[model samples]
Target: MKVLLTGATGFIGSKLLPVLTQEKYDVYTIGRSNLDYAKHTKLDLKDNFAIENLMQSLKPDICLNLAWFVKHKIYWNSDENLDCLSLSTKLMKEFYKNNPNGIFYGFGTFYQYLHDTHIGNNLYTKSKIKTYEILKDFASLSNYKTSWGFIHNVYGKGEPSEKIISYLITKLRNKEEVFVQNPFNKFDFINVVDIANQIFYAIKNNYIGDFDICYGTSFTTQEIAYMICDILNVSKDLIKINHQSDQKFEISSKPLDIYKNINIKDRLCEMIDNL
Candidate 1:
């Protein structure tokens, strides 16, 4: 099978690239530059013309779209939200027009159901929710088949951002004190490898429609810091954990419903050990 991957060098994409290769699929990756993947095409996805043009030339069998601007903290408005969706819609239309039979996997986030609420307090969350709504609605009526994968917090190696796990690991490595916010806020995190495996499964198995993939285990920030301390064989007391009441916005305490018959507890523990 021939596949087109967006954000192929991202945290999930980098890990996913090798998985596709191991499965022996002909993969074409789209991004700003080339990496260690099947074939590379440099095209800025933000430009509709460039995206459509590249899709026309490549004619990939399927497109796994995972490109998006991510930020740790931001508040987005309606116009900003729509703009992000517009880009996604244009990309989808271009891919569908070129490869009508190709499948499109729209990578979404856990903020689909939260907007204008405490959980939606974050601007990034609102934008992601808008993106999901747009894609889900388009997929329902679009001629080509499409699927939406609502992913939870992802953690693994090669993560581009100085994110939660990486940040904590970095501070711990330097033997520096790290202060975390919202210790009581329950957040769902999944291993990047497991998420990539699910996406690969969806592609190979011809999965269409919306699916939620999560680790099912909710860990607090303090707990995560403790895990890191344990992994580094350092005193947990050195890692100062303070609860930020202001940052403790309201959010769903429940975990995402995963359909896969896989256990992630041991895997999460192993990740902690990998530190």
Candidate 2:
């Protein structure tokens, strides 16, 4: 299968590339920077004409859309979210136009769920929800086979320093105080490698529709912090938990058991030791 991947240099995509290659798929990547492992095309996703032209030429059997504006706290309200949403939708349309029988897989977020309480309401979340809806609707109209994977917190080595896991790991390694504002906030963290494997599994099985790419487990901020502290043999007292901040809970739909063999604590330990 000829696979086209966006966000090839990202935290998840970087890990996913090897998995696809190991499966012997002819992979092509699009990114701002050139990827060393595969046939990479350096192109800006925001340019519709360039994207359409590339899609027409490649006509890949599968397109995995993972590109987005993912700057830490700023992405919640950044206008780049809207721009990414538009670009992603345009890419999907072009992909369909070129390869009618091609499969398209989109990465979604847990924040897309509409809860009565506006805990996760933000520009980034809203953009993801809107983008997924638009793409899914378009696929339906065209009778295209599409899969939407709603992901939770994905953590691994080589993540940006601004990410939660990276931040915690740094502080813990330095024996510095880790201040967590919303200690009660619950999250489900899946290893990036596990996420990549699940994506491969879904595509291989020809599964379609919405699925949650997360380990069927959730943890509070304090619990996760202490787990890191325990692994690093650091003082648990260094973790300061403030209960005043708004606590967000991410609920998954159709959670998968693909990551049952992996232990979260062991993963944290390995990441910390590597740092």
Candidate 3:
């Protein structure tokens, strides 16, 4: 299989490429930076004509898009949201027009929920929600094969930001105190490797439509902190829970139904241990 991958240097994309290449698939990666993979291409997706040219040249069987502007903080704001839809829509339309049979994979955030009313009042969440809505709309109308993966907290090596698990591991390794906000609030987390594996499965198996890509376990930040502390044989007392300044968004109670297809919870701790 020939696959064109965007955001090839991202947390999920980085881990996914090695596995896809090892499976004997020709992986063509498009990114701002060059990387060693099945193939390399520098693509500025904002340019529709350029993207169309690349799609016509590569003639890939699949296009896995992961590129997006993201902020680390949950409550941060950005003016980029105004143009996010235009850029993504243009890229998708060009890809779909060029290769109508090619599989189009879209990445969405699990935090973007409609039923769950206890949502965060932040621009990041709003933008993710808007992007997800567009993806859903695209999947519904597009003739080509389309799939959207709503991902939760993904942590592993090469994490762009210092996630809770990364922060805990660092603090424990240093024998220093760790501070966290709302440790009691439960959140969904997934190992980046597992997420990558599932992406391959979804493509190979021809999974079509929207899917919740997650490990299907909700653990509190405090629980994760203790898990890391236990792994390092450190005192849990060193972990301190701090309160957020503005608001208290309730824990994510969105029940993702990935259990019917696959779940990566069993290997969660083992993966963390290896990290």
Candidate 4:
């Protein structure tokens, strides 16, 4: 299969690239930076003309759209979210124009569903929901296969330092005190490798539709902090919780039977040790 991948240098893309290669798929990666593995075409996704030309030339069997503005704290309110939504829509149109029978898989976030009660409160979540809605409608009318993978919190190596797990690991490594707000907020954290594996499975099995990629388990901020402390052999006293800032967030009520065999604590420890 000839696969066209955007954001190939990203945390998930970097890991997924090798998996696709090992599966003997013909992969062409599009990103701002040149990648070490697979054939890379360095072009910004914002360049619509370049994206169109690339799509016309490659006409891949599958296009995996993983590019997005992910500055963690700032991304929720950033204008870049809208920019990504626009660019992704254009890219999808171009891909379908050139490869009508191909599959287009895009990434969504758990925040999109979690924030349904207060839609448009966060630009990132709103943009994702809008993008998915628009693209899903377009795909239905165009008779192309499309799927949206709603991802929960993904923790693993090569993640940005601002991400929760990476940030805590950095602070612990430096022996700095960690302060957490909304300690009671529960989240489903999945390892990047498992996410990559699921993507592979979806492509290989032709799983077409909206589905979540999560660990099927929820962990509180305090629980995860304690796990980090235990892994780093640090005192629990170093971790402070701000009760005043606590807010209850919705956890996934959907059953995730796909990852039943996976042990999250072991995976968390492995990630912590690697860091």
Candidate 5:
């Protein structure tokens, strides 16, 4: 299968590259930087003519888009969200126009499923929600085989430092005391590799429509901290849990047990030891 991938350098997308190649996919990546692992084009996606040319040239059987404006805490309301929204919509339209029989998979955030009372005013969430709405119409007109993977709290190597797992690993590895807010708030985290695997499984099996990319297990921030400390063989006393009401804006997403044998602790240990 020929696959055209965006955000090939991102956490989840990076993992997908290797997986797709091993599955015999002719992966062509679009990004700002060069990647020796796949056929790559360093093109700016904002250039509409360039994007249209690439789509007609590649006409890939699958388009995996994972690019967007994302920062630590500001993405929820960033002005860049609007730019991403516009760019993604244009990209999808061009792809569907060129290869009406191909597949398009866009990564969405868990915030898309949160109650309106929690994220109704959120631009990032609203944009993602809107993107899926557009995707549904496109699928109807095309091959009717599109995918939107709703993801949250992903942890693994190369993950952003702002995430709780990365934050705890950095602090605990240094043997420094770390204070955790939302200690009791439950969150389910998936390893980036597992996330990539799940995505490939869906594409390979021809699964369509909206799906949640997660482990279907919830753990508190404090619990994750302790787990990291245990893996590092550090004293658990370094974990200071702050008392606060849980952020109940979580969504109960369905878990596809594609990687049921995945061990979270083992992945954590690998990340810690490699540091």
Candidate 6:
């Protein structure tokens, strides 16, 4: 089947690309930078006309959207969240217009399930919720076999350099003193590979609607810092662990589900060594 992938160069998308290709699904990627693969288009996803033109060209059987305004700490209140939502809506419409019975999968976030108090307080969360609702509503009325994957605290290869794991790796490699903040905030992190695997499993098994994409485990920032220290065989004394609230929030204290089939511990050495 022809598959159109948005955010193919991103943390999660990059991981999923190989999985899809290995499974032999005809894949087309979208990005501003030229992709290594031949079947890709570099254009503005916000441009409705561009989407129409591209959809007319590929007419994919499935569209997996992993793009969004995720600029680390800045995305929570960014106006770009609205733009992503708009782009997603346009893509869905164009996809349906081209292949009426095709599949359209998008990524949601754990923030969408946070207490109602966070709704008006976060544009990123609010925008994602809006997109999720739109997909569900459209799917109910049309033949778009859409699915929404809710994920949070993702880490792995190709992740942003500022991410916790990446940060620790860089600092430890440089022998710089690293500070562990939000010592009590237990965040569950899913590997990009695992997230990609889950997405494929959902599509292959015909799983529809919304579902949580959790690693089924959690570790505190301090714990994670030490994990890196151990992996690097560096002195933990070079790290400072503080109890102060880091203000970095996560979805919950424990995973909503315990899907620890893939261990982050097993993957860390390879990811760190490679990066």
TM-score of each: 0.80, 0.92, 0.83, 0.91, 0.90, 0.85
On the 0 to 100 scale, the lDDT of residue 75 in model 2 is: 84
Better of 4 and 6 by lDDT: 4
lDDT of candidate 1 over 1-275, digit per residue (tens) = 88888788777888889999899998888887667643887766567888778878888888888866553343244344455567778878887888888888888877665554565666567667666677667766865688888887787766644678878877886788888877777677678888888788778888888776675566787777887777677777766667656544323433233334445445545665565
Worst 10 residues of 2 by lDDT: 111-120
Q: lDDT of all predictions, in order shown?
A: 0.72, 0.84, 0.71, 0.84, 0.81, 0.81
Point out where model 2 deviates above 4 Å: 114-119, 246-250
Candidate 3, superposed: residue stretches over 4 Å from native: 71-76, 81-84, 114-119, 245-275
* Model 6 spans with C-alpha error above 4 angstroms: 115-120, 173-175, 243-259
Best by lDDT: 4
lDDT of 6 by residue, 1-275 (tens): 89999999887888889999999999999866677888888887777888899999899999999988787889889999999999989889899899988888889887676637433369888899899889889878865688888886788877778888899889987889998876766667777777888788877776777777877667778878888888888998878877564454545432323354657777778778789
Relative to the true structure, candidate 1 reaches a TM of 0.80
Over 87-187, each residue of candidate 5 has an lDDT whose tens digit, in order, gives 78887888888888788898898777663654446988898888888888867864556888988678787767867777888988899999998676666
- For residue 146, model 6's alpha carbon misses the true position, in angstroms, by 1.6
Q: What is candidate 2's lDDT per residue for 222-241, written digit by digit as tens? A: 88889988888889989987
lDDT of 6: 0.81
lDDT of 1: 0.72
lDDT for 79 in candidate 4 is: 95
As a whole number from 0 to 100, the lDDT of residue 227 in candidate 6 is 87
Q: Please write out the lDDT profile of model 4 over residues 156-220, one tens digit for every residue.
A: 98787778888887887778988887788888888999999888888898878888888777888
